[model samples]
Target: MFSLSSSADAQVEPFKGERIDPDVTSGHLNHLTPDQQAAFNVFKDTLAKAQLYSPERPHPTHDEPTLLRFLRARRFDPQKAYKQFADAEAWRKKHNVDALYATFPVDEFERARRFYPRWTGRRDKNGLPVYVYRIASLSGPLQKELNTIPPERRYQRIVALYETMTRFVLRLCTHLPHRTEPTPISSVTTIIDLDQVSLPTLWQLRSHLQEASALATANYPETLSTIAVVNSPSFFPTVWSWIKPWFDEGTRRKVHVLGKDPGPTLRTLIDPKDLPKPYGGELDWKFEDEPALDDAAKAVISEMPKGPVVFENGEVRRPTPPDPADVSSGES
Candidate 1:
């Protein structure tokens, strides 16, 4: 159990609450003590022996940070980490992650966004990107459209969306500049707003939630640093009880559920100025084509590869990413 300090009260928190030194990249075992580093090597060797080969391409090389993520996720157990690593690699191969990344459905993504806005816009206090989701707003016509789809097709689409979103995040993090040196951003702070959630909506979306949770823990590993579920309705506890078993201890500990007012809790991790207005912040912004964001926020937004945006009313459009070479040169 790591000691995490809540910035709000400066109180010692439970779980793996150790501060990730801003200089440290996610999973960089070099920061570990000699014994831990040695153990990580053995984990890698053991992982190589596992049948985690990919037909799509060569298996990704296990870097220190990446290996360390798996090790830490499984509590530094080399055997367990190797199994988890292999399972994730296998899942990637089965899902064809490369193809999904290359051919993302911009239109479908926009529709989904309109139905349920998901985006990473502003940086939290720690300089890490914040991925926000408003599930309560995911009702109405968008839900109807989803309902029309066949079960298998719906499952496939959800998987694709998850993969695309994950890919987009990976790209954004890849381009993000280090805060100082050797600390490339690798994780995101998540906010799931549940202000107006209903039982019907929750029940309908249960599978999606479960799949997403499983994917995050089993596949994505330690990509989520902090999670805040704001505006939880009265039924949230009952819902959480049913879903709690799905989340690993690490993931569960990171999640903080807010009853109604999320301002105080959010302020602990983010500045009011940086947060969007819908969630009790000063910034006025919408998940639309043109957002009411300030200059600093706009500057950060410019770094992202622009994609299609769908309004609340049914409409479709697309925007293209800048040239990869151009993006690369700009980042450099």
Candidate 2:
């Protein structure tokens, strides 16, 4: 009968940090004699490999002998090392630079309006056509708060807030249903281009839009609908082409430095008359026909039932009416 043989399995070792040989440390300058150090220094000078001695130096110099030897052993050139370090520092500085914010240019907006196809697409689920806006007004309070911060911090803060707002808008957009075609706002007789507005102005406009959207959602739930359009083939090409290259090199540079692309997902919209003109300018074309609000949009607005000013019983009553004394004092 063949005898069964048993063999013990080799034990596996658990992972530990990388092992560095003691000999490698021994080869470092800490092990060299004064004479060796001097000789190594000469070798380093001939090799042009400098060692960084202190933080104040900002670069490596041909001072430390052991460091020189260590560099030579690694085939490190001090001049090249210094250049590499400088390049790295430069890149870091560029990345750390703050983003610049400004209002959309009026000329650019006009150009976009002229060249880009007017969105004649279907309405979103709420029966409203895609809305477009220029930076109209910025929040004075927010602007004041931003101005108080240091320049380096201010741009970063604004960018962060902008991102937050963009996300919020996207969330709102997703909730709305898709429409076959956008319903034109008949009341909007003119499409004035206010592109020359400053960044602060745009920020203010965005603030107002956000506040209004939120209020409409809360108070007139039935009336307002939110929707986001990303890479909207219908509108993105027009908007992006019009705005991208028109920005000055400084603005583009800031965008690059900040690593922000403001890609297709950045396009946003708000409904009806929420985004009004900052200071009205004449539109190139006028809408001869007035468009009516769709049933879906009306339903949204209606959902947030307003407090009754007149009761069903034909009695005039005010819900949450202001006190006469408070109204007189202008404190209501």
Candidate 3:
């Protein structure tokens, strides 16, 4: 019963329902780059197809409440997401992308000397850098002195130097591991017990001390002292493991005079001349008196609390009765 004009009118009404300006409809895309715009166009096409074909709720009909809520629920806060992506990219550029040192090798010293001689300048006759020449030039005597320093010691020194320089380089180059950041120990405490440290930790401590000593010798030669502390006999094995490779036979024997038998008691050894003058009054090898273990035992027993008497069958009991015959004999 419907006329063809009525059907055409209904189609025209839907088609011409409303017309928004393209600029107004696509205002959000104004801030996006060309690449982002291309991506958004594809996304729009996909969204349109999804709305046309899918049974799920179609794209939001309104901008303010419905569209904003949908975008928010989907975590589509474009500004925040962009900012986080930018920060991650910057961090990767700064630190994570850089080349890292593969390993600290003893031979690196010679390589460094060859490649960057100016950084490792040769000393002159009076042990000063040859400032006039750019390249390091070692005198015959200085080269001989370096060569004579026994292979093992040379390696240790070289490895120690390489570690120091590498640390300097890492601090200089990287932003990660946050160099200026403070740790709990830095704020609250300074001194640490060496006894609680592991072998690698002890090695690091030793290397640090060696670096300090070297720096002191370079800058404040007069105050430099060749002193070391051996806190316990147990640490000797680890110390010798690192030190023995660097020393000649004579130096090794002199340094490790303990030989096959480490002394029974804990002993401190120091170069006599290096000792403070007050303590150098006399060589006291003899003990004035032996330790009285009986007195020490008595002191310990006197401080002990009286405990309850216990019977053999695991029952608590009163003090056992003394012999009545012995008591009568004592009275007689």
Candidate 4:
């Protein structure tokens, strides 16, 4: 239902789109409108009645930032926010989300991950994880590899990727020294390149895309900071129409179809060092490349307490610190 512009001629012109605001922090609550604050308060008050309590914690365990996220997603409607919040909690339980992440095999995790968007182990200007998905990468050997895997395995891997984003990626962002913000980094920026999209290509990846869209909408609402559809073909308008319905309005508003030339706009949103070189950024990486967690990020994960990323109640959980001294004094 939406196109970048009204005029046909201007539609294909590549340009940076709307600005995506940063995540809300506890310190930022004073800036919220009266009604918005009230809605968040009410959402918190009703948590007990909702019975969305986490197993590891005594009461419902949502943080202030988490509370605001649900309320904002529903436009400050406390009741609506409460419903989705409860629903997501139930979804997590049904999917065994915590245990899945704790136990998913490493090799399968890495292989299945490549089919989804690649997180560049980088963050955008606002300190959000950045993901690059190249449509062209779907063809050839990758397509054959993807086909060999069972649908359920692929689905679980996608879930794990999101789990890592919440449990690992966002957690690492909170420690980046360059970012001088109190707010926790809660969302991500995605650039989906449609360089050689065609009817057959669309048909091939339709199911996976739809499932991923539905997953994001249902359980990860309000976690998208930006989505740039770049290197789009001339017939992108028609393609957009077909793809548009997959996302809800809140997410769609954040999308910008930046035709053939996306370099300029991408650089504006992301520093060149953080972005992949292909898109006029300084990072020496590409979409097909499997991202390596840099040492700093790895250290953050290693020392983390190690607990379920999120409770069944939709509350974020931080891991405890590592224990030292495995050394035994007496023997061998």
Model 3 over residues 1-25: C-alpha lDDT tens digits? Answer: 0000111112211122121111111
lDDT of 2 by residue, 1-332 (tens): 00000111110111121221112122234555565556555545544533323423544432243243333333354454344434432432343311111222323322222111122122322333433322221235544554454654433333322222222222222223433112211110112223344444543444333333332222111111222211122332333333434322222221110011112111222232322222121112222211233344344332212212221122223233345474454331
Question: All candidates' TM-scores?
Answer: 0.73, 0.21, 0.17, 0.79
lDDT of each: 0.56, 0.28, 0.26, 0.66
In angstroms, what RMSD does candidate 2 have relative to the true structure?
28.6
Instruction: Report the lDDT of model 1 for residue 5.
Output: 9
Least well predicted 10-residue stretch by lDDT in candidate 1? 1-10
RMSD of each: 8.9, 28.6, 36.8, 8.3
Give the residue spans of candidate 3 off by over 4 A.
1-198, 209-229, 256-332
| Candidate with better lDDT, 1 vs 3 | 1
Residue 8 error, candidate 3, Å: 99
List, residue by residue over 204-242, the lDDT tens digit for candidate 4.
877778777778677766667777778878777666566
When sorted by lDDT, best at the front, the candidate numbers are 4, 1, 2, 3
> Which pairs of residues collide in candidate 3?
152-245, 152-246, 153-246
What is the TM-score (0 to 1) of candidate 3?
Answer: 0.17
Say which prediction, candidate 1 or candidate 2, comes out ahead on lDDT: 1
Q: List the residue pairs that clash in candidate 1.
A: 4-17, 27-65, 28-65
Residue-level lDDT of model 1, residues 1-332, one tens digit each, is: 01110122111121132232232343453356666777787887776665342222343544444567678788777888888887887776565554443455756544554543355466666656666777765578767776786765554555555544444443344344534234444556767777778988988877766765666677767766776666777776667766767766656666665546667667767678867776767766544432233345345444333343211112222323435573344310
